[model samples]
Target: MNNASSSTPLGAARGIDPDLIAGIIIVLGAGALLTRTSDMPGMTALLPVTMLSALIVLGLLMIGRCLLRRRRRGDPEATAPAPLKVFDNARRFFGIVVAIAAYVAGVALLGFYTTTAVMIPVVAWCFGYRSLKGVLLADLIFTGGIAIIFVVLMGQELPTEFFLR
Candidate 1:
């Protein structure tokens, strides 16, 4: 076996684009959400359906971009496969997914604001952030934005914090 052939990235050799996979996954997720929201009352369903539709559109755009790039490069037919880096660390990827699941569960138990405030800093730290000030600032800004969007702008009631009750 040639050394160069052995060194080829798995995705490149397989003619698989990670972005294309991601786009298809996103579209499928959005489609699932759309189906789940279909039976909701008209006013309640409007926002979710609209957002899901937008998600689908964005996913389609990603897929289109990938296809265009492949066409331009004459992928599969081309002599050289473009090296692509997928997940650098599978552990970190799975860790983030677990963190997100925890975050979702925390939202129900601790309330949205409280859970989010804690999650932001913790996630930031896990991602190798060392600046305490930066993490705190990010936490504040994100929570504030959520508050402004859901409470002030949309006049939507968020999950009540236990202490605030």
Candidate 2:
């Protein structure tokens, strides 16, 4: 049956809204995680639960916005969705995946801070961020901030450099 041509019981046209689909998926995934985290003892589950709840809220907002937009348009199926552009830059996408894989490996070999410091700027440049000063500043601030968060605030030890291990 061509549900796209049919009107929903709510009087909205039945058409695929990728954003709505994504939102539903996000909400479901977050809810699932929230349930799993509910088993964690004491305050250990606090952060994950809070974050997951926020994610669910954001996903619901996305769904609501999509529904409202569809209602305002009155006829959603009149125009087909634009073609997904993810594959249009297939090389860049795959390159990033590979780079991330390499970054993960590098973390074990070079330690988290060292690997992250190098990867951030390199990845930024590869993505066509041409400002050298900006990239350097961003890399420093990001790496340093994370280092401070994990090592200082959290009192967690960073992975030791391979040679230092």
Best by TM-score: 1
TM-score of each: 0.78, 0.63
Candidate 1 lDDT tens digits, 22-101: 89999999999899997877766777899999999999999998887667555555554565566768899899899999
Clashes of 1: 0
RMSD of 1: 3.3
lDDT of 2 by residue, 6-109 (tens): 54423333456767887999999999989999677655566679889999999999999988777755654564343333256778869977998999899999
- Which residues of candidate 2, in runs, are more than 4 Å off? 1-15, 28-50, 75-110, 158-160
Specify the highest-lDDT model's number: 1
